[model samples]
Target: MPTLAEQLQTALRQETAVAQRLYEVMAQEQSALQRMDSASIQALAQEKSRLLAALDQQLLARQKLVPNHQVEGAVDALINTFPAAIANPLQQAVDQLRELLFRCHNQNEINGRIISASRRSVERSLSLIRGHQPDAVLYTQNGGATRMGPNRRFASA
Candidate 1:
């Protein structure tokens, strides 16, 4: 069996890899959203979900190696319990994993914003097609400002 430090190190490395992949997938998802590619976005979303689950599992495994896993800074406390030779490298791995997870989180947020913007645009278009004028001022085909009565109908069955 591997030592506790070694197991934790391996878990961190696996989690880091998953986080790195997640960041890349989120970047691709952003591009898909920009291009309005529904298929690719759907596939990438599934992949992202899988990666997140895997990362969670790896985290749980790593936590099991720490005696005080429920306590704040428990991993750091465990790292300090080891000799410098083992502890330094383990700490470095932890830092790298932390940075990758942070990047993944930021990228996910960016993707969410893109999705929100797209949804708003779609809703606005649908509202126009359904004859529901938005509260904002409107423009006519002649490039002049115009406003329609609230009861005006743009389409009918």
Candidate 2:
């Protein structure tokens, strides 16, 4: 049986993994948005929704372990590391994003600021669609069919 401390630590670590995976998936979805098609966007939207939901659930579970979990590593370190810590699984989770940010842009390392900046970049791009083209149109690859909906169209080009 895992001690409470160990169990909590494991849970905390898992939260970090969940956040990174979510970020990666969101990034991919954002890139896919460029195709200007409904089906792809729609699928991405669905996947994003699912990922967000799972993240939410994981967050809730993490919270249950948060109050007493910081025996060796901190729970907040994993969740709030944002820009200063190891958004990557291989790094040590830090306390603040500023520490990560100080690593310099060219540092190309896992720190709070750098991680936060990258996350913000992905977020900004995702926000672009929501801002400029909330109601943009999309066409399919072969230009065979065209459908109109929120992020769900694939018309033949």
Candidate 3:
């Protein structure tokens, strides 16, 4: 069996690839800007449309793999329902890994007693990670709970 870390690593790669496909679709749409030949433009547009749909499907499929939570229900459904193989299995793995990362993130907060002050920092950090606002944060100061997150917490300084 693949190590859990290895499996999760594969998942993260899959996730990044899906994001790259989104970028590629946008890039193809922008291709029309270079030259406006009707055929080439049409081709690029078609390709862009196809990629977007694929991305949407992939998103739905992987989201389904994550265990349910209120905010994540839609995503879970989407991920679960995606059909067939994506252009890249690696991308699918990444999506799954990213989802797992979030699960791990929140699990880290359990039993933590910051309640106010520094607590806001933890909540805000988690929010940002969940939103993919800046980047994905897979850890927190406190050791994780049932899932993987930062394995460290504030030392009793």
Per-model clash counts, in order, read 0, 22, 18
Score candidate 2 by lDDT. 0.52
Candidate 1 vs candidate 2, lDDT winner: 1
| Candidate 3 per-residue C-alpha lDDT over 1-157 given as tens digits, one digit per residue, 9 for 90 to 100 | 8643344344556655655654554454444433344576577567756765765665555444444523744443434444435324544564555665454334333212222434576687875555533333345458543333344332324
The true-versus-predicted C-alpha distance at residue 117 of model 3, in Å, is 49
Candidate 1 per-residue C-alpha lDDT over 49-155 given as tens digits, one digit per residue, 9 for 90 to 100: 99989888988988888887999999999999999999999999989988988888898788889989989999989888878875646678999976676776665
- The TM-score ranking, best first, is 1, 2, 3
Better of 1 and 3 by TM-score: 1
Residue-wise C-alpha lDDT for candidate 2, range 1-157, written one tens digit per residue = 9754455456656655655555555555545544445587578668767766876676677667565554545554544543433344323433222242332222323333444676677776775545433445456688764544555423334
Model 3 spans with C-alpha error above 4 angstroms: 1-12, 69-157
TM-score of 1: 0.88
Off by over 4 Å in 2: 68-91, 94-157
Better of 1 and 3 by lDDT: 1
Relative to the unseen true structure, what is the C-alpha lDDT of residue 91 in candidate 2, on a scale of 0 to 100? 34
